[model samples]
Target: MDNNMLILSEGMHTSIQDLGRKGYRAFGVPISGAMDKYSAILANKLLNNDEKLPVMEMTLIGPKILFEDNSLIVLTGADMAPHINGEAIQMNFVYKVTTSDVLSFGNLKTGARTYLGVKGGFLTEEKLNSFSYYEGVTSKEKVQKGDRLKIASIEAGLNPSSSKIKVKSAHFKEKKLEVTKGPEFNRLTKKHRELLFSKEFKIDAHNNRMGYQLKNKFPPIKNGEIITSTTIPGTIQLTPSGKLIIMMRDCPTTGGYPRILQLTDIAINQLAQKKENDSFKFDLESSFDFLGRLVNRFKD
Candidate 1:
C-alpha cells in the first residue's frame, strides 16, 4: 500500500508547517510557519531528518490519523497524551508503526502546540519555498478531516529500536520572557517602562497565529503611530489604546503601531506555547548583554 496518513479527525488547528518562507518579506509576504519552532526542530531531530522538514503543527488538540504503510514517527512540544492503537505513548520518543496502526490523542496536559514528525517528513505542497500552510499564500489554511497526507513508504529491514529523550518541564511553565528595547522604546515614559517589566500581562483572548494581544494596557504613547516601519515576529507593538500586540509567525511584514519591545528568539518560542489567559512578565535585557550571552552559548 502507498504510504499515507488519513486524517479521520482534524482536531483544533492542525496544519503543515516548516521553518517558514524566507526572503519574501520584501514582497509583503508573512512568514507563516510553526509557532513553536524549537519543538518542531526537536521533532525532526529525533527522527534523524532535516530540521526544517515539514511537520504537523497541532494546536490545543491533535488529529486522529491512520497509517496506511509502515512508518516511524515522533511527537514533541505538548503533552497531548498520544496513543498508538489504544496504547499510551510518551512524547519526545520515536516509535515505529505498521500499516493499519491508528494514532490518536487525549487531553492536552501542557503547552499550546505540538509537533508530529514522521520519518522522511510529509509529502505536502510547497509554496514560495516553504511548506507552511498560510491562508492566502497556500491552497488551504489548515488540515481538514478526510485529508490524506502522503509519506515515504518504509523500506524493508528499516525498523529501528524506539528512542526517548528528556525535556525540561519548566520550559512550558516559564513566565519570564526576555526582551530587548525596540527603536521606539525610548519614547515611553519611565513609568510605562517600569510597569512593562514589573507588571504581569495576561494573554488576551484574541491571540492567534497572526499575533498575541495582552489584556493589560498602558496609557497611550506620546506619539503612538509610526511611519509604517518594518515589523517581524516577536515585535511588541503598543497601540494608541495602550494595548500590547506581540507579532507572531504570520504577522504582516509591516505595522503602523509603535514598536516598543522585541522578544528574543528563545522568548518567541516560549510565548508560542502559551494559551489564552496565560500570564507572563517581561525580562528586559540590553542588546550588548544579550549578545554576550548568545556568544557564550555558542562557545559552550
Candidate 2:
C-alpha cells in the first residue's frame, strides 16, 4: 500500500473525519465528524470499506490533490464539481486514479459539504480513538496544501473494479426539518410554542461546524437560565435574548441556554448539509413518529 495523495491546494476547509469520538464527551470533548454522515457512509459503501472509515470532508470548496499511486476512490455528499486530470467526474461512483492524476473541483452545485472516500481509508493519527479532526484534539485540525495523506500501498498491477449507487435526490431538496420537543419545550408560552413551529427560520451567516444561528428571534422561555447541562448535536438552545442556536457536530458538550427543541437524527443529517441563507421550517413530530423516523434514518 504505497498510496498517498499530495495536497496541491487546500480548498476551503478540508479535514479527515470518521463517525466521531463517542466516549470523551464526559470530559467536554466535542464529537467532530463528517457533517453529512449519510454521504460519507455511502462513499465507504461504494469502496466496500468500513462504514466508520475516515474520509476527506470538505466544505464549499474542495482540495486539489495529486495521487501518488493508483487507487480506487469515491465522492459523495455535496455536488462539488470534482475532476480528474481536468476531466469531470460524477458523484457516488467509484473510480480508479492513476499515479500522478490530479483531482480538483469547480463550483459547488448543491449542499454544503462533500466527502471523498479512498478504497483504504486515510492513514492518519487518531485522538480519543477517532480520526475526526478538531482543534487541540488532532495534531492537524485541517488539511493543508503541503500535506501528504498516507493511504494503503497497492501493487503495480491489479484488476480494476468500481461501483455506483443512487440515492433519493429528494433528500437534498428537503426544506422541512422534523424535530421533537426538547427538555424545555414546555417552558415557552403557549403562543411562543405555536410560533416556533409556524415561523420560517433561515440559517444565519454564522453557520459553521460548531452550530447554526437561526435568523429569526425565538421567544425567550420563562426562567430560561439553567446550569450548564450535558448537550449534544441537535440540541436547540433558546437564549435569554430570544435567539435560537442549533447545536451541530462540533458543538460544545454543554450549554446554559434553554433547550427548546431537539432535532431528530434525520433532521441533524439534513441540516448538516444545509448552507447559510437556506431556510427551513421545523415540523414537530409526535413521540411515536419520532421513533419511526429514527428507525427510517438508519434504514436508508
Best-performing candidate as measured by TM-score: 1
The per-prediction tally of clashing pairs is 0, 4
Cα lDDT listed for each candidate: 0.92, 0.88
Model 2, span 1-300: residue lDDT tens: 357899999998899999999999888899988877888889888888899999999999999999998888889999999999999999988888888999999999988889999987889888889999999999888999999999876556654465567777766778789888888888888899889888989999989889999888876767978898878899999999898999999999999998888887778888988888899999998878978766887994
Model 1 TM-score, all chains together: 0.96
Candidate 1 lDDT tens digits, 84-183 = 9999999999899888999999999999999999999989998999999998888999999999999877677676556778988767999999999998
Error of 1 at 126 (Å): 0.8
Candidate 1 regions exceeding 4 Å error are 293-300
